[model samples]
Target: MTARTVRGAVGATLAAALITGVAACSNPSPGGAADAGGADSAVVGIATEPESLSPLLGYGKDGNSKIFDGLLTHDAEMKLQPALARALPEVSADGRTYTYALRQGVKFSDGAPFSAKDVVFTYRTILDAKTNNASKTELDAVESVEARGEDTVVFTLKYPYAPFAERTVLPIAPEHVAGGQDVNSGDFTTRPVGTGPYLLTGWSKGEKLSFRANPGYWGGEPAVKKFTMAVIKDDDVRLTRLRSGELDAAILPPNLARAFEKDGTRTTFAARTFDYRNVTLPTQHRVTGDLAVRQALDIAVDRGAMVDKLLDGAGKPAYGPVPTGSPWFTAGTERAHDLDRARRILDDAGWKAGEDGIRVKDGVRASFPLWYTSGDKIRQDHALAFASDAKKAGIEIRTEAGTWEVIEPRMKTDAVLAGGGSPADPDFDQYQLLTSSLGGDGFNNMARYDNPTVDRALEDGRRSGDPAARKAAYDTVQRELVKNPGYVFLTHIDHLYVVNDRWEGLGTQVEPHDHGLGSGPWWNVESWKPKQK
Candidate 1:
């Protein structure tokens, strides 16, 4: 459940096919990774790169960090599988205590032994207030983590958090390597040592992340010996590189993915994801802060048309973070695209249309700047479409494009075309998104949404272990959004990738919103094998 509030705003190129490792090629030009490595190496083109490689700083927090192993990991079916831990943790009767038996003889890529102490250090350091991890609150259920001898570790929870076991998927860092230095700004942040299938060789920010398979990996060494993730921010540029053979595989938007449909050499893989694109309505802004404006905008947007046109039938219209097909979704919570109802709501709220056809209320025009990350064609299309839809309802929305650097500062008062979702559990995404305490806390609540009822419901949903109780709690949260809409949810997009059909064992997972880095068809890249000639 790594919500991509910051990185989502950063332009990302999607993943396409199984990639062989590339040598360090920051800019995608001819003579890159595709030429350097043979069949044993693979190179992939992705849109974005992580800010830090360190697990301590929220990298791999949702599992599948290529450089590190978590206590548990999700399989192809999105089910939990043991990694550092020998098996699933033993839960207590009260559901407040969890005990894990460490997998013995496992060592980090740097050749250091992995033990219960390493687990303790990772959890303790992240939970520390001084550590600048924005995701520490996800572990708020933890009361204490104690090491039992060298082989066992135990976690005590403050409440019977139902998804506490899921949270254990967080990657563990070596205590000896990360503990001695500054947890926030340390060499380990860039050069991390972990017990995973690969080792980080180099990270060229805004360019590429280079990796080599760990020879001494606990799970046998990868068949693809070298791997490089070329960071190409523009979708068209990524497609160009992929077409020219500079990239082996890459994630592309649905419209762009169609270009390779007739190409026999490449196969397109469409992964079902919980990724939703929504517009953040900042509560601090005079226009977006109004309940009437929020409700009208929510209903005025045509989500079905967006799915049909922008996504080209690759995704479904979204009503909220929980997809309509999801069992957790409330049946009656879907918002209809009713232009008349939207006009009536605005009219009743005293927003009168001027001679210019723009709504004005009490000398303030119903207009605000909406920002999307520049160079992202998908986001640009969504922003343009949203602005067009809003125009019909007498509202003037000015859509702008900028990098996250320019947009982050204005998020408190301006709207943003934001994307985020998690397939794990409702609590995984909803708690951080809807909690009142997390408002304006660095991307936790980008809209600065503060609703007491939704906040209470999120707390109850996460704290309770009972399935019925959690369902009812989340139902309330969704229902309350209908009455007081904070974000205009657009679509739940399926991740589409095109890849060179060069390897076996290539598949996709039920991905989160934050894809490209640890998702796409190459999520299980370690298990991939070169196809026989």
Candidate 2:
């Protein structure tokens, strides 16, 4: 799974055509004009849209990609299930080689026969240096991928990577279609053909993505024929559209989801997730770079209060990237909210209180700007609360709001309220987030954290096949984060979604931070059957 920047909480700047399309749709209720296109259609409002629909550019890498199917797919329980492959891959004793027997008679949406060559092409293209897949590093364990005849694909690894099987959940692309064009900026990036149940009909960028069921789907065609994902960025707007029968479902924040609880027509679903929101204290900043200031801010903020008040009890305090409920989480690494301890740490480090109560060390004020994306209510609230908490410890934090374009460049010297996590494996997120070599490499390590001990531990955890050894290595990484905290880990949020109760088999899975697209209650939408009236 890719550790992508959480850019979901969005702005509502839709095109006029999108507005007309949404307004024309009616939901299942008395006195309504009509459903989107009757019961066979579904219009959903999601906050963010993918930059590209092509799997090679890193879309649907975690599965549930309506437009694409991975070699393996996750069931409702999130367990690995065969999709493109006939069964689970056969692993060699050394855990370095994996062989998958391709499913017979499966074809891409364009009628191209799915075979071992397509599988080999997809992996090789992603690993190519010219291709700009940011999450390509996740597949660094692959030494080679080859096809034996038309039915079998084999992957050899450089090391004994324990979670190599989980990485195969990556969606495969057709070699016949994608191989002939420019891999980076081809027509396939927008209009894609895959082995998945849904086919892309149209994509109005920043507005909506339209899909129709693939009748030739190997798994069986979806009952819901037409699926339209409205790109309404604002939370309030999404709630309005859902209420007005313009949208059948929408992913909402905890506060917005509360409004639908009393409505008999709609049902709210909450999915437990590894998604966490944290403040990136950039190591290049004069004040934040100080170990004392970083340590103070880590314990000073009230994570419990953020979960209670901001999240409205829809989440838990996150001590690190690993959720406290997860077995991977190490005990005794929890940080208590201690204002006195925070102040003392700053004071002992030669930071003295100025006349206005702000701390100053070596004539430099302990103040830095903190930015969150505009129109994101949850992030804005968290940033404000963080600034307030830091004030109590004699540190000044100035909170700001901007788009990612404005915030990305300033990340090296300023703080950002960013989000990321993956339930697939610890190495999935931790490696990209903490590795020293990944620092300043486009959202990989926004804080530029460079602890040599942590770097070694992360490598050991990902390379070792032994379960005990992996656990011990990750434990060391978590403990070291306590001593030299790079990011102030906050609340691990549970994704909340509101949908009309008109379909059976509609439920949510444990989601990643990059939800809405491949997550929410509609994760298994293809399997859903309309409720008999």
Candidate 3:
């Protein structure tokens, strides 16, 4: 959840409530209450409430990217497109093997089929270590995958990765029914099976989830045949159920997208290639393990008044974890906001300034515990505007919320709201959020931030199979994360949604970082229809 911590919580209460009204809705006039010619069935609507439907233990990309289908997908300009693998693997003049081909008559809305032994039983159940899979360290350089026949599927690599085709957007599963079971002891991860184009059907966990359109999809059936989601974690009850229409599509909050565009409804907004929001830090905490107090709280926050009064201008800032239209971002690097150079870098590190204005030294007190995820009213307005800009630089933050099962076991002793993104590449969002021993001990680095130049630029950007040496090793790991700031860049959002003009193929070629509701705008849910006056 980036954009400087999702606008210090819902972009400053949607720029203090923008409110406009009537953006679009004349399309049905002639004989309204329409459904005339057959097709218009679309139902999309979301605002969190999908913690898992098992696209390999889901981690929010809005309802497991619509009942799962990866093996390559991201298109609308975020590139790396392919889906269910038909191309984009090849390599092997000794780049340590890696074939992939399979795309024949795909199936699986339980009609089964989709082979290559379901991509070698979904990368050997995510490189089994008792299948605990949270992308087991992003497939830890697999040593094998086999199959080589029913539509081919090779792999082999223990080395030459080059982001192993962005870990083929993962979602294969089936080897004649999830091979030898124990995929992390499952009720089949709360019932799952893939191939895509929507399928789930029902769920109540939390509140709602439902879907339908698969009819043995090989890329055909879905034209929105009933897809409900509903898990409303209250952003004012998801903009009062999208302004009482009970949601035709939601996710509001840019001050309710100008009050649902003056209560009429259309809102578009875009930007999101995912950096949602950040503020991590932790690098072995103790008043945030000083790196000059995390570069003086990243030069004393502010990020252009949190993108013009809490993101009504949407969002942009952020300098590190890539995202500047990524191709490995980095251009012209600069990050400032001074506060007297953040109080002369905490008065030359001696930290003083106490008596309530915060900043103590030996007896501690700069303060920590930001965390988030509870009722998330835009991360409680970005944790009360980053605790009023870290209490004017002397620090003292404090705000916790909870439930990523109690903030994933206190992200290695606090600092939350991470929100990442990928339109399919930058090594599938920086090798699953900065690789380390992964899937074990303090996962997703929750700011444990170890760096040997970001672990040798994530192991030479995954074994550089040349794309200009993996964009000069991810532009030298985004300029060594802006000279070692280690998560705090924040702001890169754009994703708005709204939709109610009877849904005509809502943003299809897909990409603004696949804005979750299932892999960004429901990854072309078999070409959305719903407009038949």
Candidate 4:
């Protein structure tokens, strides 16, 4: 899904009315709110509003997190743990099929009994061409999903998919409720029912969404009885509301986290390999397609400076799609801001500096539009910083801001800031982004990047049953990708969430990317409790 599509609903509401000034007051002091009686009704705020409640249809992390429960979840270390499913699926001898035994009596928020049927339905719908599910590429290897029994679901794969179990992170939907209807059609996309800890209480299109605790959760009862997710797109407004106590917790830019740290409110930073902000260079674009121009853009970028100055050292310089900390991360890659090298590469490629300071090649100016979602403050800052750096290299980088609707189609011909990541594993993250066939039809491969070597490595990694072999396969892919420069590696950001210090046990994993609010940090909402005096 495009960032615009994800932010459109929230943007419309934010435009309609000014946010009421809420008191910028804490409950009492640090850890004081824990003693308050209504701690059960903890209120959290997210920077962006969710696009859809349905897990299958919602590809963005912001929205899918609220209403869906994946089969497995990752801990702070990226270790897989059971969320909806009882445990990780058992792989067959041939490594082609996976069997998962369901948790005893999980029920959907609607009180419908959740079983193997729901799991079967969720996967089948995604694999079905008619569903037109955004996540269809993730399930391309799955040949079939069948209910072995009332509590067991088995998956037959077309090939030995090493990340098959990790794919369980996709939330399951109730078969009975979602029966006979096209997955992509109708009101279900907006209004979805799932077996997560939270139940969708109310959604006002562009305003806010309210969720109540699902008392029927099989795991345990949640401490937070009611939660409200307001779609506040403006960074200033989101931070303001967070400080004013209008929200118990809020997702803030990395720079703002340090500012809030001085206050009693607790700010927690988790390392993630899941998401990175990269400049997608369209090979078809006249200016960006030139190898020298792409290399110049890469060398001109001061990634370390961007992280230290803009992000307050909360993120690491990205070498490639894989973050530095991930197991599959290839170290010693060639990424550095060398202005001399940039100038040499551009000059050697027949691109002479013109009177306007922009390079000119065959009557074409060395300038292309860099698109970013308008309201995102961090992206805006990154774009400005990137443009400033590129200017020093004699390359003209024109920046544009718009919603995803206007930007998605343009991605085919222009460069844009693409944010993507997943904490599960390498296959879960890389394969979907780089493969040619998976490009136009898949998740967010807007760059239309295609490489035969990368594709071979991806397929080898997927088919390999041995853990060591799979890691090596993915490692090779990362190394090759870094060499090819399909994407200008930017930075792997640490997600910062500022919350009232009253509550404890807010479980969050150091993700490779954001798993949405519901699945990542908020996955264990049922176990969290307000500390007693």
Best by lDDT: 2
**Which lDDT tens digits does candidate 2 get at residues 1-533?**
13433321111121222333432233333421123536898888898887677788788988899988888999888899999999999999999999999999998988889999999999999988777677888999999999999999999999999999999999999989999987766667766889999988767666777888999999899999998888888998888778888889989999999998899988999999999999998999999999999999999999999999999999999989999999899999999999999999999999999999999999999999999999989999999999999999999999999987788779899999999999999998999999998898778888999999999999999999999999999999999999999999999999999888898989888888898889998898899899998
Q: Which candidate number has the best TM-score? A: 1
By TM-score, highest first, what's the ranking?
1, 2, 4, 3
Q: Which residue pairs come into collision in candidate 2?
A: none
Residue-level lDDT tens digits of model 3 in 1-533: 31112112232233223211112112322211222122445444565543344544433322236666767755555456667778877879868787878788888877867878777776766666554445455566778889877888888888876666666676666666556554543444446677787766555544556667777778777767766666566667666655555556656557766665555446454535554567777877787777777878776887777767677767777766566765567686658777788778887988877888898888887888888888756556666676677779888888878866567667775777566765545665675566554421433556767667767777777776767877877787777766677677666666666667665666633233334455435556567676677
What would the per-residue lDDT of candidate 1 be over residues 277-361, giving only the tens digit for each residue? 9999999999999999999999999999999999999999999999998899999999989999999999999999999889999
Lowest lDDT 10-residue stretch of candidate 4: 18-27
Q: Taking the tens digit of each residue's C-alpha lDDT, what string does model 4 give over 348-432? A: 9999999888889899988889998988777878888888898888888889999876776687787887777766667666777
Q: Would you estimate the TM-scores of all the predictions?
A: 0.95, 0.94, 0.36, 0.89
Between candidates 3 and 4, name the one with more favorable lDDT. 4
Alpha-carbon runs more than 4 Å astray in model 1:
1-37
Q: Which has the better lDDT: candidate 2, or candidate 3?
A: 2
Counting only residues 3 or more apart in sequence or on different chains, how many pairs clash (N, Cα, C under 3 Å) in candidate 2?
0
Residue 18 miss distance in model 4 (angstroms): 25
What are the lDDT scores of the predictions, listed in order? 0.87, 0.87, 0.63, 0.70
Order of candidate numbers by lDDT, starting with the best: 2, 1, 4, 3
Q: Cα deviation of 469 in candidate 1 (Å)?
A: 0.4
